[model samples]
Target chain A: MAPLIGVVEFPGTNCERDVAHVLEILGGRAEILWHGESSVKGADAIVIPGGFAHGDYLRAGAIARFSPVMTAVAEFARGGGPVLGICNGFQVLTEAGLLPGALHKNSGLRFLCQEVALEVVGTDNIIGSRLEPGRVLHIPINHFEGSYVCSHDTLRNITESGQIVLRYVDNPNGSVGSIAAVANIEGNVVGMMPHPERASDVLLGSTDGIDVLGSLIDCLAGDTEPTPVDQGH
Target chain B: MRFDVKVEVRPRAGIADPEGATVGKALRALGFEGVGDSTTVHVGKLIEFDLEAPDVPTARDRVDAMCHTLLTNPVIEDYSFEVIPADSGSGD
Candidate 1:
């Protein structure tokens, strides 16, 4: 059976359609779920696409945390369902408390839009399960508030538990430990500042993201071993 | 009554503060030795308040509520305020 992936859409979620299109291209039945919805039933996996959820007012993801759809996302994640948050969606996840830490203004204090090289640091969760530890891939990141911040003890625990998913090679946003992404303790929930959906196509200057997204799909299907390209860093 | 509110927000630890560092360097160039030691902190809005409530205590409560609910992000920011009697510091 084709995997059913839910693409959640908030009011200003600009990447929902692009992510949905990519999932469809990858052989998943991608459904658009509105922010007012309350469940991710029938979904093998779910995605929170990137965008300025609420005009970034009063803080980037602050307002979107109260959306009805997030209530369902939280529930879905708690159930061990595979959930991925990209860019702005990543911010939303932290604000919703589904993920620890927070995304603060970029250190440069500029809205950066560029391709970044990321190294997969941990592979215990669904998102990282398909990728070998230490594998480097290029993904585009466009955000002003992409830096990851957390307490020292919390960072140590996440790192020791293999919850740290991705780290930027150049520390584009001044994230702690160059942390570009992380998953929950269970690994079912992942949030990343880079836009994997944007780089899923080869014509878009890189097909590197395809393998990452494909690995995510494979994980949802219960696969655990890292793919060939993902082997050896 | 007049109220003075100061909100100080800084990048959390491990987060870079290039803006603050840059200003510190500039201050040194300008020969302001003490200012050179200042780390970059983004402080915003020195808000002055004039309340219409019946009493100072009542007005203070309203302003405090406003600060919590809208004036600042409680999770990332810390605020301090001085609620001074309208004529306490200045002779009428």
Candidate 2:
């Protein structure tokens, strides 16, 4: 069966359609799950795409974490279902306690919107399973609060466990250890600041994200060693 | 009884506060005297809320829950609150 990927939609979410479209293009069925709802429609995988949910009022992802659908997302992740969060979604994940640490305003106090180079630092998780460690991916990140911060103990724990999945090649936002993406200790739930869905097409300037998205689908299909996607420059 | 609460949330020690740093830099650029390089500012949020509770302890507990669940991110922020009787004009 084709994997059913659910894209969550909050009131102010703007990237749900982009994620749904990209998932379909990658041979998966896509559905948009509403934030007010408390269920996930039995999706095989979940993607929380980027946007200023709830206007990022209290803080990025602070209010969104209380959305009704997030309870379902957390439950889904706890059941070992594949879950991916991008940009604003990443913030939501951390706020929801599905991931450790919190994202803060950029060190330069600027809302960065540009392509950044990322290195695959972890390969044990679903998102990085098929990609080679040290592979450079050029993906775009658009966010004001994207710098990830964590306690020293938490950093040491994640580093030792190989939970840090992606690292910024240029350290764009002052993330600790240059972390651009991370997974739960279980490696089933992943959160990343860079927009892999936005980078999935070559016409969009790079196809580097195909590997990330494809790896997700493969993991959902119960394939642990899926073939790597072509890394088109 | 009605209670007034003031919740202050700030980044924890050892965390970088870019917004605060930016404001401090601007203060120096604007020629604010005595704003030395050794001085640093940490910006934070002040949230005020009014609630009805039977007593001060109950009000404090409720406000504490609010800080833990919504007003602050414990991972990066530290929060404290003051609760006072709404009908009182001064401190206890």
Candidates' C-alpha lDDT: 0.77, 0.88
Candidate with maximal DockQ: 2
lDDT, candidate 2, at A208: 83
Interface RMSD of each: 3.0, 0.7
TM-score of chain A, model number 2: 0.95
Report the lDDT of model 2 for residue B48: 88
Query: How many backbone clashes can be found in candidate 2?
Result: 0
lDDT of 2: 0.88
The collision pairs in model 2 are none
Candidate 1's C-alpha runs over 4 A off are A223-233, B1-15, B22-33, B36-40, B44-76, B80-92
Two-chain DockQ for model 1: 0.27
Error of 2 at B17 (Å): 0.8
Per-residue lDDT value at A3 in model 2: 77
Q: Pick the candidate with the highest TM-score.
A: 2
Model 1 C-alpha lDDT per residue in residues B1-92, reported as the tens digit of each score? 45443433344433455566666777788887666354553433355655556567876787778666555544445566656666565755
Residue A113: error of model 2 in Å?
0.7
What digit string (tens of lDDT, one per residue) describes model 2 on residues B1-92?
Answer: 99888988988878988877777888888989777552268889999888999999899889988888888998889988899899997665
Please give, for residues A1-233, the per-residue lDDT of candidate 1 as tens digits.
Answer: 66778898888889999888777776666899888887775778889889988887767777887888777778878988888999998888887788888887787778999999999998887776457887898999999989888877889999899889999999987898999999999988889999988787778877667766776777755533332332211
